[model samples]
Target: MKGTASACGSATVINAIATGEGGAFAIDLRVKSTVSLTGDPSEISGKVGNTEEDPELIEICVEKVLERRGVRDQYGAQIETNTELPIAVGLSSSSAAANATVLATYAALGGEIEPRDAIEIGIESAFNAGTTVTGAFDDAAASYLGGGVVTDNESREILKKIDIDPEWRVLIYLPPGRSYTTEVDVERIEFLGDLVEVARESALEGNVFGAQTVNGLIYSSVLGYDSQPALDALSAGAESSGLTGTGPAIVAVSKEKNVEKIINVWNSKEGRVLKTRPSREGARIENG
Candidate 1:
């Protein structure tokens, strides 16, 4: 059997670590997975095309999905993953990988998975692969569903979905470090629960720009990440700017004519800047 799938990446508007209420928007960055099952069910393997490191997480993802289908002993596969998103940078790379892997594996099994159910399974696979805490339903949902989502992570339910404005350009600033999502200090973030609640309400009220700015500021302060980049983006007239995920990456949105200003400011900061747009498409099977 053979199958393929793809999923997008997202930036944080509100980290779900606080308030259980969080918001995020999908980006054009993506991870793609292809699964080919051979004879030996014990001969499982995986390869990641975008990085130099081992693809252990992809292997674990496939294993977990097979286990979920109660076919752990019935099949073994060679999985290949190609990604444009960076890992361990709070860009939801793991969630995207897991989501794509789950879809590809199930497709290889000739099974149909409901959309949200597939994302939930991907979240479970993340836990099994030791990649996420809090299930990261907010990130997983945005990556799987596309567009923007405001979620109740405690309930694993998306409370609202917003249509993305095509004019909004997404710029991701990649600093020089990596922060693992599962290793974050949740207590430190939760201390700002009351503030996060305010941000959540702001998103609910259609003020995503304000919500993201505040949430990013609060998290950047408590998490020891420099907030200067976001400030610079705002000074350049961005619609919204803030720390995305944990640290080392900042997400800046702009619909104004001053996109060059934002890009120039980031380029001057010594970190890489990736330009992408809002994604309105979610994970789907590419082939079988």
Candidate 2:
């Protein structure tokens, strides 16, 4: 049996580490995963393309799906994933990968799983792989459901899913390095819980860009990342700009008129710039 699926990546409007409540919006960047059952029932293998291989995350996703279906002892699988989203740069790459892998694995088993179940399975896989803190429910929901989502990560509940304006462009500044969520300083972020709450409230009130700016400022300060890129994006007419996940990458939201201006400002920096738009489409099976 074989299956293929794809899921979009997302940028943080509010990183949930500080407050259990967080927000995110989907982007056009995507991860695709293909799964094929093998004759060997005890061996599962995985490969990732366009970045470093993370066999552990892939295997965890596949194994979890097999176990959920009570077929873990009956089938092994070979999983392959490719992505335009950069890993460890806080673009929801892990969540997207897990979603695609889980969906693909289910399809390979000649069935489909609910999106919520797939997201939970992906969260479990992420925790097992030590790829996230707080299970990243906000990121997972945004990636799997598309558009913008405000979630209570602690409760694994989506409080809101906003259909974002598609005309807005998302500009990402990718620096040379990467920051993993597992390495974040939880204490430092939690110390400013009151501040993060304000950002979360702003997101709930439909001021997503404003919330993103607030979140970016707070996290960047606590995480010791240079906030200059985000600041420059704002100066260049971006409606919202901030550090997305942890560090080393900054995201700016703006209209088409300001996209070039923001890109020019980001291009002057040390890293490269990627341009994409908000997506209302979520994860889906590509082929059965």
Candidate 3:
């Protein structure tokens, strides 16, 4: 039997709220999609291609999972992705791709899945696929639910969803280079032990705007990246600004009236700047 499914996974900016014990909140954006498969895997074994963006990790992941499931040589499938989200730029590209591909493939296989359950499955798949650190349950949950979500990455637990004012516009700054999350020294993160508590408290108070800034500052210091641009955005009238994930990408929460101003400042720097809105809906199946 052969089957196909398509899923959309959003990009995450950071863990807004994180406990020293490891709880986190994520801001999600839906701008990328993935397709998955479950028939004649051998047909796509050597047919996969890379286009400057290193999607090889994701492809290899799918192949390995299928092979382990004893169905590697029995499927022929193609995954084509169209995305505005940049990979390896700390925009949750990998997570989005993983969720989309898994959902698509499951659909192709004639399987059924609940929305939240599917995101959980994607988290497990990503860990097994070696494509993520911390399993990123916060990011995964945000990608699945849209808007903002708080979660425990270790336990794959969702703590809460904070409703963001619709008037907010999310703007991103994309540096010319990519930073791999895996390459980040875990020691650096561990070094910021005390700061995690401060950030987590900010998130719990529903002060995500402050939470993102603090989290970004801590990570920027650890990653050896500049935090000036993000801080500059805030100074320039943006509501909130911070680095996303381990980042080369900086994110700003702004009002539409101020989006252009935020974009101008971000573009003034030596990076690509983008403006986007929060996605209200989570993942959806385009076809059965």
Candidate 4:
């Protein structure tokens, strides 16, 4: 596969911000992209597929975007993703993949697609490809910019950028089970939308610790998942604790000194634990 464009990765809070909207926060993590177009157009596949509201649709969506750009098909392009982020566990996997694919495709073509434009386009692709519920521009932007961001998706505005104090570590708790954001019934959560807005305001006011913790509780109550794990994190002296995106994965924010205690408490239960820090950069393009 021939033309190439690539971008970095970020995380968003999703539907937790914006008036009459939801909450989202983007975190910077590891991300890179590579694109190739050859005479051979190979079928791409991964653990992510159309089954169970598969978040892997982000890859397919990128391919479709490439096709729409008319740079592929005639020349053809292939995208491969390698990341530590898990799918359907509310970790912004789709947003990261979309950011990488679009930026790599642009790089391969040697054209100019501003980072902001690239992020907006990637969000649109996720919507068109049926992988997202509300276009998820907040998540897309965080995935694009790599620092903490609060965005209003409906108005297409960024309300704030929070420079996470590097002293903090983001510890994520992943249960063996998976939950898809696309599969969630928005109408059922609509009643809780007001609570989501409250969380959003706290996030914009530089209360991310409070925002994430409260957002996690609100979504947990609505989604019918256990909030005990997150509570446990907070109980262990974490600076902040809450759900990551929708369900199943609980995030705890803490200083380096508290890492072992947090991990010990998390692993004491039945779950997978990941220790990570905020990524300061977004996406990039590379060569074979």
* Tens digits of lDDT, candidate 3, 1-288: 333333323334344223323322223444333344545546543222245554554465455446545677776555555555676787776666666655555555566657666676677767765667677776666666666675666666666676676567878888889887667677657767678667766676787777778788877887798999988899878877777877888888887888887777777878787766666555655543
lDDT of each: 0.86, 0.91, 0.63, 0.68
What C-alpha lDDT does candidate 1 achieve relative to the native structure? 0.86
Task: Compute each candidate's TM-score over C-alphas.
Answer: 0.95, 0.98, 0.83, 0.86
Query: What are the C-alpha RMSDs, in order, of all predicted structures?
Result: 1.6, 1.1, 3.6, 3.3
Candidate 1 lDDT over 209-236, as tens digits, reads 8888999999999899899999999999
lDDT of the structure predicted as candidate 2? 0.91
Per-residue accuracy of model 2 over 33-73 as CA lDDT, tens digit each: 99999878889989998556667898899999898899889
Q: Which residue pairs in candidate 2 collide?
A: none
Candidate with the larger TM-score of 1 and 4 = 1
**Backbone collision tally, model 4:** 38
- Better-scoring candidate (TM-score), 1 or 3: 1
Question: Which residue pairs come into collision in candidate 1?
Answer: none
lDDT of 4 by residue, 94-124 (tens): 7877787777666666665677877777877
Q: Residue 283 in candidate 4 has what lDDT?
A: 64
